[model samples]
Target chain A: MAEVMEKTALFEFLCRMGDNTLILGHRVSEWCGHAPVLEEDIALANTALDLIGQTQLWLEYAAEVEGKGRSADDLAFLRDVWDFRNVLMLELPNGDFGQTLMRQFLFDAWQVVMLGHLVRSSDTRVSEIAEKASKEVAYHLDRSRGTVIGLGDGTEESNARMQAALERLWPYVGEMFASDETDAAMLAAGVAPDPASLRAEFDAIVLPALAEATLTVPEGDFAHKGGRDGGMHTEHLGHILCTMQWLQRAYPGAKW
Target chain B: MVASVEQVWDWLDAVPDPEIPVISLVDLGIIRNVAWAGDTLQVTVTPTYSGCPATSIINLDIETALRDHGVEKIELKRQLSPAWTTDWLSDKGREKLEEYGIAPPQPAGGPERCPHCGSTAVEKLSQFGSTPCKAQWRCTECLEPFDYFKCI
Candidate 1:
């Protein structure tokens, strides 16, 4: 690949990584106090804050590199649904505490693998941010994994719901490590991992936990795709945008 | 005539949080000690929590504000050993926090009440609140969720 194309790929992948956290952070914040139980609610909200904090640095760096007047808030709030580049898996609704736990567990497990790989990245900015964020994410993943087991193995109803949630989210899982041209370039440049390499580790971490929870791992290679380059999004994203961007749109540039 | 610590204290009052914008570091009890070592003024400050996003900005704000007050050769030292405890919050700060719709740190002991409506019958919604220094809490009476300035 040409040097320019390689640079563009690195830029694009960084933005993808940044926007995923921003979008997911915004989504999880919706459950602030509306959670079913208080302890679980705190756990979810805390995790959400960690993701948002990590993404702030990532997005700010991305905007600086993009060399546009657009700030992270502009990219996060002003963009249309189609303009966002977050993964489809993250856009799924907060099904329930059980499902949310399962989702966080799955995502955190993958993030640990990705961040562990990312710390070795040649691109210093991304690696530096990932290194600082890795410590916070380790705690987040542990909390999520604990709750997932508690819910998945806790009761008949919970086990059934956990199983259903896992099956529903599984189809979208493969797309996570599907390295496109941008991913290829970032991997080659060492700005990001070769997503191709993290698959076994991701599976290894999650499968054993799922087995312990008495949860069945879904099968078949039929992967549902979308969100690599922002083709589409889940309906929940619209509501998320409405609430998140309300203050920004109401008074542009007003510090409140 | 010599300037007293009380006079120096008055000069430091204008240092508001760069992020929260409502409370001064004095109100937050982050301003630990203001003393003079020769002509050099030593300002000892502690952040509300480690890894708080606002610490860097707050440090800069303190330096600038004090310099504006004509204090020269200032040294800002961070005291992380005792760490920062919410017990440092002044009574006036607690009142201001309640009026501002966010709760103050629970009085240096047990049982943190809800800030929105003074109810001990409160539950922690999350360990993380709007910022890392806070814990999300909701009052059963008011049902309003508020940030608890976490005890260090």
Candidate 2:
């Protein structure tokens, strides 16, 4: 019984990691060919590709741990929104290029710190995945941090847009650090660090980058929760899944 | 009859990287291990990036190259530990990349010289390029754009 519970917790934890990348990847891919400039469009598409690729690794591992005979594609394309474990911020709409990048910067900061700790996970599979992912995440954080700084400090209009993006995205940030029983299980198993434990390191990376960008860190820590725990999600996730899962839903085993 | 592991390596060395065709997979340094497990031959490969679109193609290319060489019982294993790094790129690969008009990765986080003009004046156009493994850079001296294999 305890073993089953542990497996269940592991599956949940892995889903959280995979779903974040999948949802955020889809959001980023939406910018392809639509970005303001040629370089920016290519960059966004590349970023999206990386995220989706990482999603495959994470979800493939998740499915193996679940022992449910489900493949990564099934978990990605068949699950309903309520079953998703990604954070609320990832599923939110891309308001603009600045907003999209601002969201990326915030998420990349958290991911870099989180993956750093994960590299030391007692689970070798988790550690291996983290080891591979950290390199890519490092590059991502570098690009996003530079873009945030460049745009935030550039013009009066650009600064206003970046600041607004920060404010809008700030509330969702707290949910990333919110801990619960699943985190407790991971911590006890030495599989991962507590989500709350990651906040200090995340802030260390994010706060300074924001400062360098001349952007405010926002006031208060009032967080809206329930996404990671799979309790509630924003309305936007269903719409994303509607389009993302369309082919699989309609064809019921479509292949290339 | 089983082909020797060294022979397998030699065959694989002739297989070019699908994306950068100027360099072979061995030169790219992603083929980690090759061995025979009884009657079956196993080849271990690592991906340059987790999300790189070329990984599948690279794997298929390896299989095709091996089969063409008459190695029928084969297994391609994907290994993720220790990860892949540009530091593993062979010196021959670096020279080929430069000769092909693409700058090689540098520890300084950018290109040291232009592949087109061999001039030290170069600027990064974007952090990303046409593929996941490269970045866009331009030579100020030649007024030409080129790709740089990003050092991970």
Candidate 3:
């Protein structure tokens, strides 16, 4: 790949990573006041803040790499649906407590494995960010896993709810492993890990936990893809962007 | 007379963390190095978390603190090689955190203790708290809820 192409690929990869966290953070924040308990309310909010804070760093770096003079806010609060590159699993509505936990557990399981590889990235900045984020995600994985296990084994109603959530979310899990030209370029450049390689580890980490919780991993060959190329997103993303970008779009150069 | 590096260190010791407020940035173990680099005072600091909101403010505070001590031409370098950990926190800093009703972080994977009543009968209320660095906890013995600075 040419130097310019490599940079563009790297930029897209960063955007994809950033958008995943940014959109998921928005969904998690919706639980701020509505969580079943005050402790959960605070925990979910803290997770949201961590994800958003990470969004700031990743997007800011993406903007810098693009050399378009765009700030992190510009990229985050101004992008459109076709421009977003987050996996569909992240943008799905947080249905119930079980659904929310299922969504988070599925993602956090993959993220922990992914970050383990990213921490050893050839890129210094990428590795640094990964190193810091891995710690937080490790804790996140523990919390989500514990909640999922408890709910899965707790009662008939809880078990049924978790089973449904798992089936709904399983299709999206495949999309997380699908790679594109940008991912190939990033992997070649040693700036990113081979996302394909993380899939087995993700399954290894998530499976035993699921079994321990007495939950079944749903079978789904109908995996969805395309967010990586910035060509598509779920309907939920539009509403999220509308609310998240409102202040910036209205003021054009808003600051607080 | 030019101020010694010790003087600069003293100034930083007085700079409280914006989030915890009870602990100094130096005592909290964020400051990695402070030295003169070619007519400029260079301070190397590591953020506790990559996304910590206090990172920029902590940098600004370091600059302001040094400038107030009549030091000019200061440089702040953010290093992340050896990521910041709770083990870096000074003993005095841990005491301050406990005194403020926030349990200081134990070594990674260590059992948590209650900041209030010195009870080992503490359960986590949440894995997170008011700030990214802390977790909410409550003691069964004293029944007092508090914040635990999570080891990260």
For DockQ, candidate 1 versus 2, the one ahead is: 2
What ranges in model 2 sit over 4 Å off? none
Write down the TM-score of every candidate. 0.70, 0.99, 0.95
Looking at candidate 1, what is the lDDT of residue A111?
Answer: 87
How many residue pairs clash per model? Answer: 2, 0, 0
lDDT of each: 0.75, 0.94, 0.86
Candidates sorted on DockQ, descending: 2, 3, 1
Error of 3 at A80 (Å): 1.5
Ranking of all candidate structures by their TM-score, best first: 2, 3, 1
Instruction: Report chain A TM-scores, every model.
Output: 0.94, 0.99, 0.98
* Superposition TM-score, candidate 1 onto the true structure: 0.70
Q: Who wins the DockQ comparison?
A: 2
Candidate 2 backbone collisions, by pair: none
Query: What does candidate 1's lDDT look like per residue over B8-120, in tens digits?
Result: 77777777777566777887788889888888778898655434668889888888887777776889886533445677777877787777777776545223677666788
Off by over 4 Å in 3: B108-112
Better of 1 and 3 by DockQ: 3
All DockQ scores:
0.14, 0.92, 0.67
What order do you get sorting by lDDT, best first? 2, 3, 1
| Residue lDDT tens for model 3, B1-152 | 67778888888999999998899999999999889877899889988866677888898888888888888899898787687888899999999998998888877543367777988998877887888888888899999989888887
